[model samples]
Target: MKKLFTTDFKQRCINLMLHEQHTVAETSKIMNVSISALQRWKVQYIKEKQGITPVKPAITAEQREIQRLRTEVEQLRSDNALLKKVSAFFLDKH
Candidate 1:
């Protein structure tokens, strides 16, 4: 997955957390995300708004592709492992 810069993620997260009155865990769950992930985003937002350098905005397609590819790669790895085991069984003598 692409690493989000500190500021932008934080700002969006704050928007969600504050205006929505979302709990750390609840917000994360509704978004299908982890609490620590949102927490980190919150930190980055605060740090940047406090005077740190700005983070670039994320593209939806790019983020979607990142998640998709990560899942695909994992599945491919698992399939390859199974194939390797099957091949080994076929090649080995009893």
Candidate 2:
């Protein structure tokens, strides 16, 4: 029998490899997934990033929402940092 993995689990594995800078071998051992599966997931992730639909393990709606929110949070943080710099500059002038 084959083991079925959840979308969230797959996403976490990809994140570990991409964001955390883990090698495929390390991710496979740590996540207990096969190297082949990790490679496939990486390909799918790249395709998705390029705006192409993946062949399998399609990203769920919830995952898409989370990604969107993460991007929004990053943008907001950048804006906040700029605002703080501007405020400090004005304070120094006055």
> RMSD of each candidate?
11.6, 12.2
Judge candidate 1 at residue 21 and give its lDDT.
Answer: 89
lDDT of each: 0.64, 0.83
Candidate 1: misplaced stretches above 4 Å? Answer: 1-12, 54-94
Model 1, residue pairs in steric clash: none
TM-scores, all models, native as reference:
0.44, 0.61
The residue-by-residue lDDT of candidate 2 on 1-94, one tens digit each, is 7889888898899999999999999999999999999998888777777666544546545446656777799999999999999999999999
TM-score of 2: 0.61
Pick the TM-score winner. 2
